[model samples]
Target: MRLSCLQENLSKGLAIVGRAAASRSTLPITSNVLVATDEGRLKLSATNLEIAVSCWIGAKIEEEGATTVPAKLLTEFIGSLPNDKIEMALSAKKILTMKCARFEARMTGVDARDFPPIPRVENGVAVKVDVAEFKKGVARVVFAAATDESRPVLTGIDALFEGSVLTLAAADGFRLAVYKMPLAEAASQKVKAIIPAKTLSEVSRLLSDGDESIGITVDTQKSQILFKLKNVELVSQLLQGAFPQYSQIIPQSHTTRAVVETPAFLMAARTAQIFARDGGGIVRLIMTPGGGKTPGRLSITARSEEIGEDQAELDAAVSGEEAKIAFNGKYLLDVLGVISEGQVALEVTGPSSPGVIRPVGTDNYVHVVMPMFVQW
Candidate 1:
């Protein structure tokens, strides 16, 4: 393949698809990216069996052909070169020659036929949604997905589409996150599937154009899902297993509630965590309302014999009586970090019950974190 393209365009395309190249795979082809020149453009493709990414960049094509080269090496080399135009040509014996102003490098390559064929979006139902909206939904819930592979279903986020509404949910036994958003165009029919977190993360990163919309198609029969943007496409294999009924775990009501600034609460929890190592990184929250109509004070405390103790207090809108609750510091901070809004509502039943954290105005998104028990 012989093509001339801008350095920035080529570098961006390589960075996007290069993520899917297997770092250590038994098959040598899996470690390489397929570069093909066609229709006056250069196409970059990479896959690791489960996930695949393809990107196209406008290029001056002198010859139409395809070749495979190591993804990391090419990306690093291209990134280090000057910002001038780059000319790439594949010669006989499968060698790739890259040339820029006053610089040139010849790299060994493999036959394009050795690369695995990426799945196509043909015959799949397409749903369109705004890029930023879709990315926000994924970000809110993807972090809650279980990292442990024992329960394959919990390791993925559940995506459900009904009418024009899209919902993303994830749970790891200890906590759960759910986010819902409206889609611009809905599929004629409803669709539900469990998509791995790794796949969703890649999709989120590929959505660089904020004004653009994304087309998502799912092939249930083949257990594959594809995401299409302006000049990029990603295909991933769906996780096979039934996700648990997470709705049953969410509490309907709580005896105590507090509305506090999201950033303030997160900072306090993080600081308290420094002293909570002995108790599995637990942080305690005590909500006490002063007399009259003044805002209540929420005090966060963490105590460990080895690390001493730390405490912080913040003003909050509290209802009900005084209450003290303990929770895992990391879980609380993770939920807080994903919320974009300013104010957060914390609903609790007691120390042993699960604490729910949610944005002040929205019921469409909710985070449930199980609290830990505190002695004395």
Candidate 2:
């Protein structure tokens, strides 16, 4: 391809697809980024077989061609160049020549035909979702997905699209997070998809690139899902398996409920995490009800045999009798950190039962976390 584009746009386009390129793949071509001319614009694409990302940038095309070049080398080189026009030309022998601001380089790359073609989900149902709403729900749900590959289904986020609402849920055996969001436009059909949590995490990052709305397409025939933005798109292979019934995992009722400030509770958990790290990552919580004169309080404490102990107390709006529970410090912090509300409500039936956490002002998000079994 013979084209000229601004250094700023080239650098940003490379950064967008760099993460999808395979770092260590058996197929050598997977490590290369496909640079091609598409509909009068320069298209950059990268894929690791499981996921693919592509972005288009405006360019002045002199000649139409395509080439596959080393993704890391090209990304770093373009990023270091000055903000000037970059001229790129590909030879018949697959050598890519580039010059920008007096710098010159010739790199040998594979032919574009050798690179795997990006998938196109033809005849797939299209759904429009508000980018801001999707990002918030994804951020809260993806953290609960299991990182281990032993249970493949648990590593994916269960997405249900029905009517004008989209529900996302994830669980990792220890904690579960569920979020329901309203779509920008009503979908024509109902669908259920299990998308990889890793891909959703990347999607969440891409939403911050200033896209007001995102287009979603589910291709069951190809077992893939596509996310398209104004100038970028990502396609991912869906995980094939049945997700557990998450509704049954959430506690139906609670004997004790405590409402406290989200920030204060988060800070207490953060400080406890430092001490809990060496002590099985356990943080103990104690909630006490107030009588006629005394104020209700929730006390957090963590102890380690080698290190010291941490204790913090926050006033809460507690009801029911006193309750005690213990949880992994990181898990507690993960849920509390994502909560945007001013206050959060915690429901505990008993120390052995699961603890239910919900944002005080919103009914769209809820979390159920299993308490760590420990000596009281």
Candidate 3:
């Protein structure tokens, strides 16, 4: 194999595909990145048994061949080279040789045929989604996925595509996050799949700022999902199991509603977290509505018996009735940090019930947090 490519493109491609290379795996080939010439471009791929990433970069191919090299070594070496042309060649003994500018190196590699084959999915129900909206939805929903491996279903995001809409829902048993966005193209039939949060996060990160749309294919026959970007492709195995019926978890109505500014609420939560760290991570939220010409108030407080207590108040648009709720300080910070709207609405039925949070101007997102059982 012989090929020449720009250092910049090779470096970027390595960085993108190297993410899937397994650091510690039972299969040694999974730690290597497969390099080959496809059509008129160079293809770099890596897999860790769960997900695979493939990136194509332009190159001048003198001969057609393939080999697997250490991902970390190649990425580091290519990244250290200057912005110049890199010439690479492979020998029959599985030796990968490369030259860039004034530097040259030869490394031992493995036969490419031993590397895991990336599942090729062509016949499947495909849906296109706007890149910007898809990234936003992933950012809002993936954080709620369960990190514990005991419940496998909760570790994945519930993806539902029907007609022209796509919904992403994730939960960790304590909190739930749901986001909906219009698809760039309409789907022919309803499709449901549970995609791992880690894979979706990587897909979101791979989407460049210049990308306009992303194509998602649900291949039920293969039990895998594929994401196709402009120059990159990601394939992940679907988790087998039934996701929770999350539609019933979202509250339909609320007795107490409070509208608070996003920045203010986030700031209060951040401050409360500092003190709540010593107090079992509990933060208290008290909403008081005003009558006549008086203004409404929302108090955020946290206390530690060994340390001290702190509280911050913000003017809010409160209605219905007064409410006091205790919540995990970290949970409050997580949901509030994702909200970008000017004001956020909080709906609570009572101290024992879950609190629903929604951005005032957007109906596309909703978050539910269970209240902590603590003394008032």
Candidate 4:
């Protein structure tokens, strides 16, 4: 097999599919990227059994053949070459010969026949989502997913497509994040799937590389989902489990609400975290109601035996009864770090119940965080 392609294109294509190459696997082929010629173009693909990535780059194919090479070695070699044309040839003995302007190398490879087949979306319900909106939505919720694999369900993001809207939700027992966005095109039918957070995070990163909308296909029978962009495609296995009923955990109503600037709130949380780290990461949010002409005040405080206490106050448009709540400073910072809105509304029923954080003027997103117990 022989092919010639631009170095930049080959480097970019390798980067796109290299993320799926298995780092530690019993099968050596799992860590290799498949290089093949398809329809006069060079295709690069890698899979880690759970997820697969494929990328196609423009090339001149002399002899059509395929082979598998170490993903990391190929990517690094291509990335180090000049931006000139690169020539590659695979010999019958499974050796990949690569040549650039001033450098040439021969790398050992395996036959492409050993690589696992990447599932194709032959027929499935396709939905289109705006790239910017999809990335933003994913950023807001993916962080809430549990990193620990103890409960596999909580380590995935729940994707629900109904009507013309798509909802993505993630929870780690202590906190939950949910985001809804209007699809560019309506789905053919209702579809629900739990996708691993790592896969969704990769999809989000790929979306940022281009401004084009993304095509999503869900194949429930095969238990796989496909995401297609202009030049890259990602396919991942759906998590096999029923996601928790998240709606019931959200508070029906809040007894108190406060609107404050998100940046200010985040700063307060970060400052409190320094001392809170020694005290079980506990931070206090005290909302004091205003009477007559005075405006309500929200105070963020943290205290530790080894470190002095710290506090920050911000005026808020508080309504309903005053409430005080304690929460983990790190969790509060995580929620605040992902919010894009300038102002956020914090709602709570009481100190014992979960506190809900919503971006002001946005009804499509909600964040609920459980409170920590503290002796008053």
Candidate 5:
């Protein structure tokens, strides 16, 4: 393949697809990126079996061909080149020659045919959603996914469609995050798919901050899904088992409730975590009400035998009855950081039952945290 493209465009395309390159794969082709020149454009592709990404850039194509080159080396080299046009050509022996200004380098490459073929989304139902909305939904739930591979189903975020609403949910047994948003084009179709957290994270990064729209195609037969942006496409394999029925765990009612400033609560929890253990950081919350009309006092405490103890208090609007609960400080902070609202409502059933945290004036999203048992 021979193509001449601007340095900026080439660098951007490489960075986009380079994210999928396998870092520790047994196959040599998985570590390399496929570069193909066709129809006056240069296409770059990378795959790690589970996920694949492809991007196209406008180029001046002199010869139509394809080859696989080292993804990281090519990306770093192109990024270091001067702000001039770059010329890339492949010889008969699959040697890639890159030249920009006076700098020139040659690297041996493998045949493009050796690279695994990405799944083709030929006939599948396509759904369109706003990029910003999709990214926001992902941010609210992706962090709650379990990283342990022992239960593969728990490592994926469940995307369910019903009517015009799309709900994304993730739970790691300790904490659960659920976010729901309305789809622009409502299809009466229902789709339930478990998408890997790693794949969703990459898709979230690919989405720009603008108001552009994205197309999602689901292939049920092949057990694959495709996300298409302006000039890039991401294909991911869906996780196979049945996700647990998480709704049964959410409490239908609460006996105690408190409304507090989101930022204040987050700050207190983060500071209290200093005294918590490394693996399972625990924090205790004590809610005290003064009178019928007076606001309540929220106190946070954390203690570790090896470390020290911490305590902080903040005034909050409390109702129902007084309650004390213990939880993982890091989990509380993670849920609080994603909320865009100023106030947050904490609903508690008891010390043993899970606590639900919801942003004020929003019923579409709910964060649930399982209480931690403190021996002291």
Candidate 6:
């Protein structure tokens, strides 16, 4: 294979697909990125069996062939080269020769035939979504996915499409996040599937690179989902299982509700985390109702045997009865960190029941966190 391409375009493609390449796997070929000539363009692809990413770069293809090279080495080498055009040629022995302004290197690679075939989106149901809205929906829920893969379904985000609405949900047992958005084009058929959080996270990043609408294809027959953004496409295997029934867990009504500033609440929780770390990462929220002329206030506190205590009070608009609840500091902070700037509403049924959180004046997203059992 012989081709010449711009340094910036090639570098960006490598960086985007490199994340899907396996570093150390039983199959050595999975560590390599397949470079090929496709209809006057250079196609770069990488896969770890679960997810596959392909990016095409504009290139001058002198010869038609393909080869697989170490993803890390090629990515680093291409990124270090100058902004000039890069010429690459592969010999019969599968050695890749790369040259730019003053740099020259030869790297041995494996034949492209040994690489796994990436799934393609052919005649599948496609839907269009607003890039900014889709990204925001993904951010609001992806972090809540389970990091520990004990429950495979929980490690992914549950994507449910019905008519013109799309709902994305993620949960780690301790907390659950759900975001809803309207799709630009209504899907012809309803579908539900669990997609790996890692894949969704990468797709979210790719959306920012372009201002165009994103195209999503769900091929349920092949159990593969495809996300198309500009010249890049991501294909991932759908996790086969039913996500937990999360709607029943969310409290219908709260005994107490507190509306507090997002930044102030986040800052107080972060400061308290310093002390909460030593004591099961516990952060307590105490809400009180206002009387005739007094304003309601929410008291945030954390304490530990080794570390001192931290306490702060923020004025809040409280409704219903007064209540105090204990929660894992990290869990609370995680939800607060991703919330868009504005006031947030906290709803609690009791000290032991789960607490619900949602941004004020917006019904698009909601988070439910299970309260910790603590003696107070």
Q: Give the alpha carbon lDDT tens digit for every residue of 234-270 in model 5.
A: 9999999998898987889998888889899888888
- Mark the 10 consecutive residues where model 4 has the least summed lDDT: 203-212
Models, CA RMSD each: 1.4, 1.0, 0.7, 1.0, 1.5, 1.2
Instruction: Please identify model 6 stretches exceeding 4 Å from their true place.
Output: none
- Which tens-of-lDDT digit does each residue in 1-376 have in candidate 3? 9999999999999999999999999999999999999998999999999999999999999999999999999999999999999999999898999999999999999999999999898877898999999999999999999999999999999999999999999999999999999999988899999999999999999999989999999988898999999999999999999999988988898989999999999999999999999999999999999888888989999999999999999999999999998999998899998885589998999999999999998899999999999998
- Candidate No. with top lDDT: 3
The number of the candidate with the highest TM-score is 3
For candidate 4, write residues 1-376 as lDDT tens digits: 9989999999989988999999999998999999999999999999999999999999999999999999999999899999999999988898999999989999999889999999897676789999989999999999999999999999999999997999999999999999999999999999999999999999988775456699999998899999999988999999999999999999989999999999989988999999899989999999988889999989999999887899999989899988999999988999999994599999999999999999998899999999999997
Compute the lDDT for candidate 6: 0.92
Give model 2's clash tally.
0
lDDT of 3: 0.95
Error of 1 at 236 (Å): 0.5
| Full-model lDDT for every candidate | 0.89, 0.93, 0.95, 0.93, 0.88, 0.92
* Candidates in descending lDDT order: 3, 2, 4, 6, 1, 5
Which wins on TM-score, candidate 2 or candidate 5?
A: 2
Name the regions of candidate 1 deviating beyond 4 angstroms: none
Cα error of candidate 6 at position 294, Å? 1.5
Against the true structure, candidate 5 has what lDDT?
0.88
Lowest lDDT 10-residue stretch of candidate 6: 205-214
* Estimated TM-score for each candidate: 0.96, 0.98, 0.99, 0.98, 0.96, 0.98
Instruction: Give the alpha carbon lDDT tens digit for every residue of 7-110 in model 2.
Output: 99999999999999999999999999999999899999999999999999999998999999999999999999999999999998889999999998899989
Q: Indicate the residue-level lDDT of 259 in model 1.
A: 93
